[model samples]
Target: MTGEELGRDEENTAVAGPVDADGSAEIGELIGRLSGDDDLDRETRGRLLGRLARLLGQSARKAGAAGVARGKWLTDLLVAAAPHIPIRDLETLRAHHHGLIGEELADSVVRVASNGTTAVGAAGGALAAVEFVAPPLLLTAPAQLAAETLVIAAIEVKMIAELHAVYQVRVDGTGTARGAAFLTSWARQRGVNPLESGSLTSALGSAAKSALRKRLLKTLGRSMSTMGPFLTGAAAGAALNRAATKKLAEHVRKDLRGGADPIKPLPGGYPSVGPADKP
Candidate 1:
């Protein structure tokens, strides 16, 4: 074939290539270098990490608020279904991280079940719950918001944990795990229980690590599109949150079936576990 004809054929082939999972063309090598590079200047790396953290925090908070709203709805649904859901204690809830973690976790789970990757399933379940209850937000704004925030925080915790795993960050019981512990303690001070508060940290950390690796592989599979580091990070966070939330909802569903109580009592006040508990 003539050189020009060969060139045209190649160009056309490129144009016809399949799109990446995130809708962007592949920029695998670049993304790998950026994500994997540890030798980059500290300032640059710090900035990138900070930016991602901020985005995640903001997304988490928004998601948390949404979760609180959903939680209120779910609580009402539970009550309607059994008329004896056992009123969740505000004092107990407060002990669980200022209500932030609880709100985020609830929100995250609802989002996963409602408008997330498994939206169909979530929506079905949510609708069923709604049919039974009058809807929480319309009834109690603060409680609803708190529940949503708890769910979102749970997803974020999982996401961060997952990222730490992918990066091979030593969990020597230090770093993120420690941070999570501290956060848990902080929540307890406000009256939230460890079961709920600790769950958020664990969920977020696990989700982040798992999602980061999955997203990395997904980014690698495409051919033409390139995802900037920032975008990739965000996408990874979002995906991880969605997955974690779904898992959490499944757990919740199981608990509900088992007649689990909404809030559990913590062993002690704040920081239930200590440094020695680190593994």
Candidate 2:
């Protein structure tokens, strides 16, 4: 090859080298960004979600190419990505709910988060239904499923983080450290252990790994169950997602406390609704 051609090739390789150089770290950063409490506009929020989904899709693709079973690949991905899922900080969450505090703030967080997860489930179901009939779209199902899995996981992670905020539990760490703390909580489906050290390591251990795998399998099963005929699948998908999110939240709440009543609602008989509550 000519010298000029060789130089151009080297430049291209240099540019592509760093993109996948630290795959896990990059994935964690993306998750952190999505789960963070940044005040992004609607369009920007949508774009970040899309980016995270695409990264997940690529992760699945790479694993499949390496001969990993689809189910196992997905479980592994979810476990690795969980800690990085961006969870909103208490200040941002409280601000969004305006005058809500304690149980009332917690209620608003779950309500909004459940709505978001349910929407993702419905959309994923509809997409699956479409892929069922369209030959041209069949190849997209796995990627779509992978994306859906990450998005739903992120939502649940957020729920876990915010619930801790509600209970006045302090999770120690900033940035990824904080994210990892809650990731462990989500994997175990329980509250954070304030006394534990290096929660990120614990989260990646065999016990946490097993827990996450089981949880993801259950979620995947629910998604797969909605793969019937189109209309039926869509309806089932929505209801299934909504119910599942509520169920998960209730269980986590109980684990946080012995199924106690919601922190008594704030005084004045009602919460001052914030802008977040508006459509």
Candidate 3:
């Protein structure tokens, strides 16, 4: 084949190749890095953390303007983005975490996820505070907070999915199907239903939608406190995010645990457990 033709064919193959391969690998790498021991120096960690926070802020801005999470906007936004979220399956997760299993695996997931959400909040808050100094930036605070809120939601949703995997709560479907299920769980701030039909239709009932909207508004309002001037806003933002993430992890863990006995670690740090409801 001619050079140009060969190059064109290669480009087409690249474009048609499995997109999730790269995306899934990236998500796995991100989770692995975050869940690993804190080895980076303080300055390096701070820089990385800040960059993540800024990225979350950017994501939040794309979801909505004026920080209003009402009606169908939040729901629609999530549904549209659900297919793009990179969700690793159980085997993939096990590989990423060095075969850690049961409660230890679960703990690492929650810790890293919480750190991410808190970083988003602190970064968004700091940016918002800076706006107070520059009047023009004042107009941007709501958007920044909005971005932070969405980004935090995404992180928590991914955590919920991985936690389900940790507990061996098998969710059946394509990656997008599983993502929608967990995305719904994230919106409701609740645990996934193992018996759920794995269909998007049944997930977004009127009542659930209403509750989701209310919850989003409440979260956004709390984020507003992070808009205070300077250091005050930054401190409040970080604390709020940290506490919120911790609370979310607790609630999700409780639901996932489902009154079952604590997961006992097996040989090689993997847990030999299944969902409590499973026979």
Candidate 4:
């Protein structure tokens, strides 16, 4: 090969090397950005999903129809990425909600998270695990909507963590400790009770792993709607996510209290989702 041609090849290799070498970190960053934002516009959201799709494409063109705990891969990634998920503090929550506090603050947090999840679903984002299941054509969907599942989980985890802060439900530990505790709470679909065994671990226990896998599968089920025609997918995915988020928030808010009263969906069920979370 001529020197110029070889030099161009070298330049291209240099550019692509980082992505190939550090895909996991990159994916974690993407998850953080997508989940942390309450106002990710559609174009930006689509671009980010495209990046995620390309990265997942590198691992393998096909995904294994792995047996029970088919969510194992997703769970593993989430545990590793938990520490990196962006969780706002109580001050941020109060600021974001216009000084709302107590049950009012709690209510707004749930609404924001529910709306964020809805934005992810309606963004016309990644085709998700479709690359793993069906023909490799059109948008790249994670195998069984793996991408959406992870992003949605991150949003929920962040919200749950923030909720603890809102209620002054102090989970004593380092950041990683708190992240892990909150992650476990997300997997269990409950709140982290500070008084109970500390609830802090850097890794998932086998039981927690099981619960996470189950949780992931449940989220994945909702994502299946995205496989339908475009509008149908977006609408169904949004509605399902909004409803699920509100339900999970109910469980968590109750879990966070002393003699916590049982919580249920708003009398008529969740309010309709907006184009994005307000502000």
Best by lDDT: 4
What would the per-residue lDDT of candidate 2 be over residues 1-279, giving only the tens digit for each residue? Answer: 100100012223110122245365566566555444455454564455455556666766667665334356665655455544545556767777796887788788888777766666656666667778998867666566556666677778778777876776655433333444454456556665444332222223444445556676667767765566685765676687778777777777775664643221112211111122111
| RMSD to truth, every model | 22.8, 13.0, 10.8, 12.7
Q: Write the residue-wise lDDT of candidate 4 on 45-162 in tens digits.
A: 8677667657655542433446323677677666655655666667766777898989998988888899998887876433433333456465455533677788899889888888
Candidate 1 lDDT by residue in tens digits, 185-264: 22221211223433212212333223322332232221001111323433443454356445544444333333344323
Q: Which candidate achieves the best TM-score against the true structure? A: 4
Return the clash pairs for model 3, or none. Answer: 60-147
In the predicted model 2, the residue pairs found to clash are 35-86
Candidate order, lDDT descending: 4, 2, 3, 1
lDDT of candidates 1 onward, in order: 0.28, 0.56, 0.55, 0.64
TM-score of 4: 0.77
- What is the TM-score of each predicted model, taking all chains together? 0.22, 0.69, 0.66, 0.77
lDDT of 1 at 121: 19
- Return the candidate ranking by TM-score, descending: 4, 2, 3, 1
Instruction: Report the C-alpha displacement of residue 115, candidate 1, in angstroms.
Output: 8.9
Evaluate residue 144 in candidate 3 and report its C-alpha lDDT on the 0 to 100 scale.
59
| Total clashes for model 1 | 63
Task: Mark the regions of model 2 whose C-alpha exceeds 4 Å error after superposition.
Answer: 1-58, 65-72, 79-84, 173-178, 195-203, 258-279
RMSD of 4: 12.7
